[model samples]
Target: MSQMQQITAQGRQIEQDSFAIIDHEIERDHGGHSFSPEQWAVVRRAIHTSGDFEFAKLFHFSDGAVERGIEAIRNGAKIISDVNMIVTGLAPRRMQPFGVEAHCLISDPEVIAEATEQGSTRAKVAMQYAARLGWLDGGIIAIGNAPTALYEAMSLCQQGKINPALIIGLPVGFVKADESKRDLMATQLPYIACDGRKGGSPLVVAALHALMVEAAK
Candidate 1:
């Protein structure tokens, strides 16, 4: 347990001489530090002015996560593994079910391209497929190193078209992570984020499952 908890459970002890000195110091300590009335009024007004919001139900997108999580949300599922299929016509496993009901954000459509295709041409072809379909309701762009993705997310929010319930910036490699994390926190939305790293597809998959379990209720 913590030191404060231990002290709370067991009374503090001190030598008699030291106790008198400490007691005087304690007595001089500020006891009534508080917000000013005007400050409190402003806080109250801000709370009152905030508006209502819709729940995302459950949401997630990963460059290479299992599509089982796709069914977690109402209409969305998971991106199709085959780029040519996506580019030509086939929908992602999770798209049709949740597409209209959710807004899906893809952070590094580039990443998907890199992993799923041979070169930029194929990737761009795949991207056009995604672009044409666009973000389903609860989807979000999730690049941890890129500020542009965060800006895209914010722009969507500002438009009042798509608001994400979860933004998971679980990017890989030796990239810096603080900026994306800060951006996620600033969104005031439900967020499950990872830092500069890799090698935890299971954890990412599990987080989506957890969101599904919670959102089910």
Candidate 2:
């Protein structure tokens, strides 16, 4: 059999082994946070996907996050991200069940022009333009690369320029990553974030994919 076939065939066994390790070896911290049943499913899946034990401790979900994300999926909310890598990682097979599409407009010429004219980064400019789109009124926004992108999304939401169903802000960097997440946490909006600079496109995609999996269920 082919290598791909072999891997596919062992999928169940792999999952079993992973779960065994998590259940038998890993332990939650003393007086640490815990998640709801649905939220726990996402966290478990993320740990399996990334092979990162820290995931369980890193993920922070605002109250009612799972329910809100599921409702948005059922309502056919679109997903937008700051970078193309995020859109690429979110496979169509997983997103099709919800009848939604993933979008990344960071490289659009208009966005570039707006950024140059406004003296802002393309990532921020993209968000500024996207905030005017009617579809994002209740869509999901994911930011995994640039901190400015996350800040723009939050600003748009706070100003009533756009209202997203949920925002997954986990951009990775030393500059403003931690501060952006802190700002997100301070907001009244529903959000899921990795609380420090230890985040990136892959982590953001994982969180989103986990939510989509739960929504499908």
Candidate 3:
């Protein structure tokens, strides 16, 4: 399908003709030392939490998801990544952010094996910590496994389980992964999902900005 066709079907509201947008209040205190105190505060807050930040999240596709996840936590967001070793590989990185919780969905064993340290002590420890704290309970859930993941975000909405300001991070670079994200958008939840080839963390950030900006109106 052509890009034009996809756009037409989605009925997108193109106000800026900018599908991929990134918005961050440019720090006036730039350079290396700028916002040193503020940055520390962010890090400290993340650390204070027990790896479970009341923030709902969403992540799919790409094995490099861990890198994006680290970025998400730094920005005070939770994560839901595709089932793989990305989270484990990023365990050390995420540990610093402190209370950043992560949930993952699995489908392929070959991919899983290629992703994690299957039985390694550190990996096991991370898993244990996540489970005990409700930070990593997501494994594989067919329809029974977090189905609300895509079609509906009722988990966050109906029960008010998370902060209404919760955001989603979908960095999927896979084909089928697009469907899941589309399902997510169907719910109109506040989220950030960027295009794969034409984006990176910027995509998620753009979506975040859209929600924040739209809400104020």
* Candidate closest to the true structure, highest lDDT: 2
Q: Where's the lowest-lDDT run of ten residues in candidate 2?
A: 24-33
Query: Residue-wise lDDT of candidate 2 within 58-144, one digit each (tens)?
Result: 888888877888788877798889999999998787788889888898999999988999999999988887876665688888898
Q: Please state the error at residue 139 of candidate 2 in Å.
A: 0.7
Candidate 1 residue-wise lDDT, 119-192, digit = tens: 43332233234334554244533332333344444555567655443454433344334555456555555454
By TM-score, who's the top model here? 2
Better of 1 and 3 by lDDT: 1
The sequence of per-residue lDDT tens digits that candidate 3 reaches over residues 45-139 is: 22222222211122222232223333444444444433343344333332343454444434434334533655322322332332344532222
Distance from true location, Cα of 211 in model 3, Å: 16
TM-scores for all predictions:
0.36, 0.89, 0.31
All candidates' lDDT scores?
A: 0.36, 0.82, 0.33
The positional error of residue 27 in candidate 2, measured at the CA in angstroms, is: 3.5
User: In model 3, what are the clashing residue pairs, if there are any?
Assistant: 51-99, 59-80, 141-145
Clashes of 3: 3
Clashes of 2: 0
C-alpha RMSD of each candidate structure in angstroms: 17.0, 2.5, 17.3
